[model samples]
Target: MSRASPRYDRRVRLYDTYTRGLVELPPPPGPIGMYFCGPTVYQRIHVGNAIPFVLPLWLKRWLELDGYQTKLVINITDINDKIYDAAPGASAKLSTDATAWYIEDTGLLGLGRPDVEPTAVETVPDQIRTISALVDAGHAYESDGDVYYRVGSFPEYGRLSGQNPDQVEEQEPNARKEDPRDFALWKANKPTEDTWWDSPWGRGRPGWHIECSVMAEKHLGPEFEIHGGGLDLVFPHHENELAQSRALGHGFAHIWTHNGLLRFGGEKMSKSVGNVVSLREALDRWGREALLVFFLSGHWRKPLDYTDETMAAARAQWTDFVASVYDPSEERPARGWEALAEALEDDFNTPEALAILHEWRAAGQLELMKRGLSVFGLEIERVEPPAEVNVFKEARDAARAERNFEAADDNRARIEEHGWTVRDRPDGSVLVPKP
Candidate 1:
């Protein structure tokens, strides 16, 4: 395939409507502006929490690979309903403090760090400013220190989620809204939790949905490129974000991207389900690279099943790539990395990208494999090669005959380098790496 073609120059479609049935999705004219929903700092992020990270990271990398500059902003919701509930046992001083801990933990868990990591609390002033502007514009109201978006003010409120506002009004009468479909722009805080600056309504903090809208506007500008998060958040979260930004007469994201959930045994991996896998445990087991490799193997928009066996296979695959890289018979290059580039350009299709890499490795195009893998954060190196038992047997016999302990140890290393891992047996003999 010729690397330069008119079709190859087209913009990649990172967002689609069918996921949540969003409309008005076209690629941005300039750089792709992206905002992803980040973790709330209530608890250690689980493996399920990692699905969102993997998808966006790939999208960001693919955009750059496709020659489009990207500004990726991930907002941390420091203050939220969940954070308030979790604050009782929190040792941190501020909501931002707790959120920072979670962000650090996420990086440790092998989620590729975001370019601009902003927190909700840090942008409270901006959030207040946005709410104030909406109030001034008659799109929001102060109801006893609680600011709510006027769903009636925004006629296209339910368009993003494809839900009829009237239907929601009928079903959710007990909803926390002025109009049953109207969502909160700011929530009045109580004495027990974090409180904020005074608003026309009262002294309180920002709402859940408003945090992202304000943050995205403040950083990425009113009209940006891409907005993405978990599929679960598409309803009230992204929908409200879109309405709030657009109702203010500023451009919201041109396209919205979302990733599917990571399931456990056919059920969502939630704490209540008792299938919650901690990010710490997964990192400790697979290391960061293997965990990423495992996650990126599946399509971002597809539901992924996690299990012990699946992880083992990902590890094996990663180890093979590393071993191949270490092969002294091969040489690596830089320019011809377009094989993987094309795969990524096709909607960030990581599975196809990975297949191209495997094919390149098989054909001894080691440079291309190494280059493509580097861009995707999958570079593997060999400290030592796997050992061979036959070589070990030869070295063992020679060592026993000459009583040369040093030569025996050297040969043991050789055997270990070939692939068979060596273990010291009960009889003071070494066991080689098997399978």
Candidate 2:
């Protein structure tokens, strides 16, 4: 491709945590493959867990809108210490149930799904083969039946996290480790842990980090355009994946894009602090558009607070967008969705894009506004008010024509009571269904 090609000139640029810079995305006609690290299904996911789910789905839609063929892969880690600890005897069943809940909950967000949602349990053979290759290459070691990655073998161990190799602290401390900083590739099964897989190391499950590496490779292959997750994964979870995959000579992801965590009451939402809000509860409270708009209110790389006040504001924003369709069309110079697209192209800045959406709405660029909202799955379908609403609307219209302002006001209140409002367009008064 020439440097003057649209691929080069209009390519999406995103912040890569690995490079610690805003980097140009590889231009496409060629498929852009993205791998997002998904939840470890020990329990039903929280609102914090849903950020990774929403960000990539939105990115994929935007890329497709820009003429790129995209494949998005989100992996589920069903085999992890969390699962074992959460459900001792029924770890497998718990993970299975939680995975189902995760799919059902995230599906409620109304965004289109990923191309692939591979589970760790389903890819054990692929993981073992990769781990064995790592062992053969002297990138890993076995001690007392457990397998661990030799961190020193990969000299660029802390490059992604920006910590010196010598300064990186031990992630998993076991006396049998060759080095204190080395992390588990395969953990030997415990007496209480019922979920075990047969591997070269022994009967044990793949470690948390290796599960993602294998699942990502199995679906998207050894090389891809982007690997994404929440900001919290930057250190050990993602760094380990980068080190292990690179050690095996796989090219892996070119860019690492992480979304900010969802915080509640000024702290990261945690079960320990008793502020954890389930995704289901959030969806139930705020509905799909408001919850999504809340996410859009903040840049993908910055923290967002989850409070009633914030959600209420998001709901109001969504109400404004929905109501715009009923108002008279103010045909201004067309934006063609380019202004919002420009915001997205410059590092996927969702908050700025959202502001542009508001501008489009205010400028009466309804068509452009709708086109932009669809990219983020914030669809606004204009529905007619019910028959009962029409009675009041007609009465209100007649009263206004007869110069009975008091009766017209009464009819307006009655219509609003039924969750419908009247917007007097240039054509006529239109009854719009309320949010």
Candidate 3:
């Protein structure tokens, strides 16, 4: 695709976790393929989980705006130990219901759905094939009924997470494994479990790490543009995926992007930790624009704390922006939009982009402000005041002109009762909806 903006004209640099630095993405011959690690459908996804989900939407929108067709794949992890534990006798039913709820909740954020959403249950055959290839290549082994990836066999195992292989702790300790750090490619089905799939080894389910690897390969092919998830997945999950895919002789993902975790009270918000805030609850308390503005206030790569003060501040910021909307026909400078685009081009620097937006709004560049806000997926609707509101406003204006200060104040209070705010200007007053 042709580059539509100078911001994406082969000059933008995105940070890759593999390289540990900013690297330029080569112009793709076709659509850019992006794979994001999605939810494990054991329960409702919290706000922290939405960061990875929403960040990719921003990237996809920016890329498409710059004339690049993007294919985004987000996998639903339906087969996992957590799902079984959460539902006990009805794991499959739980996953199916949770997956549907996930779609509904994220849709509330107003970001469009991904191009492809493959489930682990549907892609079991592909996963079994990948595991078989790994075993044949001697990168994995089958013990009893479980298949484990031999960590020692992959020489470059620690490059992605920068952990010394010898020093890395074993995630799932199994006495039957050759090495302590060896991870499962497939787990043997337990007699107590209800969900099971037929594989070469036995009736079992795919591991968490292997699910993403197989799903990405099946949908986006072996090579893709970007692989993204939360920073928490960097160590064990992504590190294992890197080893397993590369050992199978495929260039998995060119750029590995990770968003910082959302925190509450200076600690990572986790359901297990009993500190999670549901995405629905947050969106209900605060509007979608305010929630998005809160996310945009900080850098995507930096951890952001969610607190009442921070949320209130974001609400105020959004209200202020909405209040500033004026005549779209008014002429404004274009420099602000250019500055915002430049910031976004630099590894999606949202904080810098937001600062430029504020500067434009303060400078009375309402048209430019509206355009800039739209680029970040914000829209400012121009609402017309009701006739009764105009009547009160005109009464206030007349009272002030006649030097009736008490009457003017009373009329202003009456307008406020109608859920409108009066912003006095040198020439006249502007009526804005109450924030």
Clashes in each model (backbone N, CA, C under 3 Å)?
17, 0, 0
List pairs with backbone clashes in candidate 3. none
Candidate 2 positional error at 159, Å: 0.6
Positional deviation of 300 in candidate 3, in angstroms? 0.9
* TM-score (all chains, Cα) for each model: 0.82, 0.95, 0.94
Worst 10 residues of 1 by lDDT: 21-30
Stretches of candidate 1 off by over 4 Å are: 1-8, 18-29, 89-97, 109-112, 169-176, 326-338, 384-435
Evaluate all candidate structures by whole-model CA lDDT and list the values in order: 0.72, 0.89, 0.86
- Taking all chains together, the TM-score of candidate 2 against the true structure is 0.95
Q: After superposition, how far is residue 15 of candidate 1 from its true place, in Å?
A: 3.5
Choose 2 or 3, whichever is better by lDDT. 2
Residues 264-380, candidate 1: write the lDDT tens digits.
Answer: 877899988899887778888887777877887888878887888878888877766765653322444433566566666566778888787777776668767777777766665
lDDT of 3 at 365: 85
Alpha carbon lDDT at 124, candidate 2 = 90
Cα shift from native, residue 248, model 3 (Å): 0.8
Task: Report how far off residue 356 is in candidate 3 (Å).
Answer: 1.3
